[model samples]
Target: MKIGLYFGTFNPIHVGHLTLANHIAEHSNLDQVWFVVTPQSPFKKKSSLLDNHQRLEMVYRATKDYDKLRPSDIEFGLNQPNYTIDTLTYLHEKFPNHEFALIMGEDNLKSFHKWKNYEIILENHYIYVYPRLTKVKTASQFKDHPKIFNISAPIMGLSSTFIRQEIKAGKNIRPMLPEHVWEYLDEMNFYK
Candidate 1:
């Protein structure tokens, strides 16, 4: 099986994330797109992130209806601050029969060199890069890499930070997230 690992903090699984994952699953030739909920990101701030369990639950609730796109807590058992290479390595060991591809945004590809063993990641795993609203594109050096794929997916400008701010201000952002997730956020009064 070919699986695309769409890893993230998923502080809250918003519509943009779901849209991107669905696009990848439908167009990227992968059998599944797993939203690997990171417990901690080496590159992001942890202070404002929701607890991993809550974030994972939100991912599950938001993606329960989708068969190909779903949430994964694979990184929850791994050591923090989680790095992509390490997680991919562990996954390879556990699922030796499956071929795993790393799914990321073009904004991330711009900083790909900063990651640990980036060359190894490029050499071993296939990369599916979805476009983000950022000006950043894939770096020139990696443009011709065979393992990398630049997918033309629907652009979702909505962001989790913006959604959180809207919720904090008592604005309506239900349309920007899954219906169930909005209810979960409301029931928990999260981000208030």
Candidate 2:
């Protein structure tokens, strides 16, 4: 099985997240795009992040209906300050037969070298990068890189930060989130 691991904190899963995963599954050779919910990200601050369980539960509710896309808590059991290389290594070790591909954004592509054991990650697995419009224009930086394949996913620019802010401000966040997730957030009063 060819699985594309879409790693994210998913402070709360949004439509943009699901849309990109679905697009990747349809456009690429990947059979499944697993939304790997990381407990901690090396590059991101944890202060603003929602609890892992809350985030994971939201992700599960958001993706329950999709067959090609699913939520994963693989990094929860692993040590903190979780790095991409380590998670990828663990996934490969556990599922020897399945080919694991790393799903990332253009933003991450620019800072790939800063990751731990980046060389190993590049050499061992395929990196599927989706466009994330930013002033830096890092997408072109690795346009034809051997290990990285640029795939065309939606460019909504929807971010979890914006979603959280809207929720806290009592703005309608239904547009950004899936119906179930919006309902879940409404019921739990998440980020309010």
Candidate 3:
């Protein structure tokens, strides 16, 4: 199976994440899209960030109904401050038969060159780039690279930070999250 890894902290999984993952899974040749829940870096603690399992639970609730989407906590067991290269290598070894690709935003593509072992990553796996509201230009090398595919998914301006802020301000951000995820957050009193 071909799986596209969509990495995020997902402090609280929301609609924007679901929509983007679903769109890519349905529109692209990828067989499935994995919402790879990134674990918090041990070096930089943020008060607002939920525990890794809590965030993973939110992701599970958000994606439970989608056949093509699934939640992944692969990074939780890895070393802290893990890089993409490490995770990719680990997954490749674990699932040798499956072809893995990366799902990223246009904004990340702009700074792709700075990532550790970026050349090795490009040589081994494909990258699926979705549109983002960024003015920065992508690196010229990636503009027409064979390993990189530009997916014309809709640009979602919504963000987890904005949702958290709205919740903290006592605003009903129900529309911004999945029904189950909203209930989970409400029950846990997260970001409030």
Which candidate number has the best lDDT? 3
| Cα lDDT tens digits for candidate 1, 32-58 | 999998786556766768888999999
Candidate 2 to native Cα RMSD, angstroms: 2.3
User: CA RMSD for every model?
Assistant: 1.8, 2.3, 0.7
TM-score of each: 0.94, 0.92, 0.98
In order, what lDDT does every prediction score? 0.89, 0.86, 0.94
Candidate 3: regions farther than 4 A off: none
Predicted model with the maximum TM-score: 3
- State each candidate's clash count: 0, 0, 0
**Pick by TM-score: 1 or 3, better one:** 3
Per-residue CA lDDT of candidate 2, range 55-174, in tens? 899889988888888889999999877778888878889998999999988888888877899878888899998887683466453667797888878886899999989888889889
Off by over 4 Å in 1: 41-46
Better of 1 and 3 by lDDT: 3
lDDT of 1 at 103: 92
For residues 1-192, what per-residue lDDT tens digits would candidate 3 score against the true structure?
999999999978889899999999999999999999999888996779999999999999999999999999999999988999999999988999999999999989988999999999999999999998765688899989999999989889999999999999999999999999999999999999
What lDDT would candidate 3 get against the real structure? 0.94
Question: Where does the lowest 10-residue lDDT sum fall in candidate 2?
Answer: 133-142
Task: State model 1's lDDT.
Answer: 0.89
